[model samples]
Target: MRLLYSIVMLVLTFSASADISGRVVRVLDGDTVEILQASRERTRIRLAGIDAPEKNQPFGQRSRQFLTRLVAQRHVRISGDERDRYGRILGTVWLDGEDINAVMVRNGLAWAYRYRGKATEPQYAEPEAGARAVKSGLWADPAPVEPGLWRKMQKTPE
Candidate 1:
């Protein structure tokens, strides 16, 4: 049974990890965008491996603006597998061969995504560290809040 489950998981991973190329039609936020494919289909992509500040959070607009400057109306390639609960494709966005997801973290505009308090993408650790050391972007805040924690705080009754 374990072997069968492993095989199924492998198949699902491969099927989901398709490469997509399209023009970035909109920058929804620091970590999300709308891509217009050649087929004229619009797909919402949630950048993999990083979580940017929420729209109302400090430096959130700047994060979005920076991402816009990087990829807005530009052609990009997305490589990833899986979708979020909201149906946004989870992918690494590449523009001019640069990893936009890593850029966001390196610039301190976003945090390396974590699941259960563990970093999901180890490669981002060094960049995030460097950004912190330099006090870049949101890191300049004396006490920057992680987006996840901020969300939970928002839901708690005042």
Candidate 2:
């Protein structure tokens, strides 16, 4: 089961890379964000390092609110590792030279996903470490639901 999970994760990591700079027009869930580039080029950006709760799951809206507070309708530069299954460009979002992915990790609002690739950007493992140590945001709660687990739970839809 672990091997299968790894293989599936690996497949998701191997993809194409594209560089684009644009404005963050919308925040889709937590990990996924949308950017509106010039010439009306709209690209969906998946946060490279961190994963947040799904919209319908617990803490979902809070995650979106956090993202909105951090970057709402602002200009951000996107550096891609690759596009994911949903056709969203997976990359690090930089706002004024600061990496939003790293920031999310530092805030305890996300987890450092272990997926690896060059198409994968530098999601330094330390951000999450610091966040966990300080107990920021959801981490302050006795227990916080992992985005992956939330995704799985939502799949069966009780």
Candidate 3:
């Protein structure tokens, strides 16, 4: 059993390290999106720059819908960065010359995520501030929970 577990761990570790790309076919929410890459391969990408409230939260759907409006199933360019503990790609998605990550923060859909990675570019910081100032997304709440955390909470058994 232990040997089988080791093999599974190795496979999962290698799988997580493999880099691939696909067109963002769907935006699941503020932090999760579905991609249809070459050969009909499908993947879910978490935008690296920002994090938004969970779908169950007040502005969760709004943030997700906002992302859809910004860019939905667009032909995008994806590259891997440092993987978070969740093994989600910390990649920058681009549609034309615009950075989708930056756009999310600017439009009040997400908050700049600077925890796992280093501080983002100053220009990147601008959008988050603007969005927060306008009370967009969770910024409007007196105390809003992050979408990732909300997901964890929902899964916990009473």
Candidate 4:
């Protein structure tokens, strides 16, 4: 039974790791984009390992604009892992070998979003630390709230 369980897990993992390539039709925000696939199907993708400000949050527009400039109408390679709760593919976006997720964190346009009790990407930490140390982009704010916390605060009646 243990062997069977391990085999099942391996199969599931492999099945979820899809290699998708497409042109970015839209930059929904700093950490989300719409890709038009080679098959001519469009899919929304949420960038993995990072979260940018919500549209209504501070620096949100800047984050979106920055992402647009980086990827809009550009062909990208997506190393997808899973579908998010919202049905958006969760993946690392690459453009000419550049990891867009890491770039966002390095530029301080997005946070390295690692949930407690979840596996964290070691590659994400250094860029975030460097950005924070230098007070770049959104980090320039003395008290920048994370996008998750900012969303919670918005939901809680002021």
Candidate 5:
């Protein structure tokens, strides 16, 4: 049993380290997408270091649309070192040399999600600050509800 556990752990480690490249097959939302590899396998990826609004939240549709317009059907490169609890690869996405994760934040389509005591890179931070300053997209609301808070509120009894 111990040997089996060790082997599983080793495989998981190696899998996480593998770099990924594929064409985007679907845009599930502003921060998630399905990529289809040349081998016909599909991998779900969650855009790292950012959180866009929930589908029902304000600016949600626009966020999805923005992402779809940017990368749907395009080949992308993913350099991720981790996966989220949901088994989605957590990574930075690049399309035509553009950082799609940062682009979403810069356009005010998403928020830089600071996790584990580390804030996102300046690639995400500077644009977010600029977007907030300009009142772009969701920031245009007098008070926009954060995606995290919005998710919690959705589960509470009204």
Candidate 6:
């Protein structure tokens, strides 16, 4: 079992290190996008380490629009190797050499993605703090809800 785990880890590491170049074909939401790779494959990527508002949530459409303005139809480099349960590639997107994930949070369009109430990536903390301090984008809302919490509320019985 340990050997199997090690092998899986190795494979994941290798894949994560492999960079894929593609052109953004669609922006599914603030944190999700579809890209057409040079190999002619369409890949769905979930921006790593950031969470944006849902389509129905406050600032959701705005978040998507912001991302669209940044990467729509532009060629980018994707650097991530893991696959989420939804079969989407979990990775960081780079456009014009800028890290889009960090940009989203820094601009207050998204939050540093958290797992179990803890931040999964530390690099986004400072950006989030700055955005919050200035009330930028989604932060302008006095009581903006995190997308995860919003999702739960949506599923709860009223």
Top lDDT prediction, candidate number: 6
Compared with the true structure, the alpha-carbon lDDT of candidate 6 equals 0.95
What is the clash tally of candidate 5? 0
What does the lDDT read for residue 96 in candidate 5? 82
Could you tell me which 10 consecutive residues in candidate 3 have the lowest summed lDDT? 114-123
Off by over 4 Å in 5: 1-15, 116-118
Q: What would the per-residue lDDT of candidate 4 be over residues 31-111, giving only the tens digit for each residue?
A: 999999999999999999888999888889999999999999999999977889999999999999999999999999998
Question: lDDT per residue, candidate 2, 39-67, as tens digits?
Answer: 78888888876777677766678878898
Clashes of each: 0, 1, 2, 0, 0, 1
Better of 2 and 3 by TM-score: 2
Q: Model 1, residue 22: displacement in angstroms?
A: 0.4
Q: What is the C-alpha lDDT of each candidate?
A: 0.94, 0.77, 0.75, 0.90, 0.91, 0.95
Residue 139, candidate 6: Cα error in Å is 0.7
Tens digits of per-residue lDDT for model 1 on 4-86? Answer: 99999999887777799899999999999999999999999999989999999999999999999999999999998789999
lDDT comparing candidate 3 with the true structure: 0.75
Residue 110, candidate 2: how far off, in angstroms? Answer: 0.9
Error of 4 at 82 (Å): 0.7
For candidate 1, the clash count comes to: 0
Whole-structure CA lDDT of model 5: 0.91
lDDT of 5 by residue, 30-80 (tens): 999999999999999999999999888999999999999999999999988
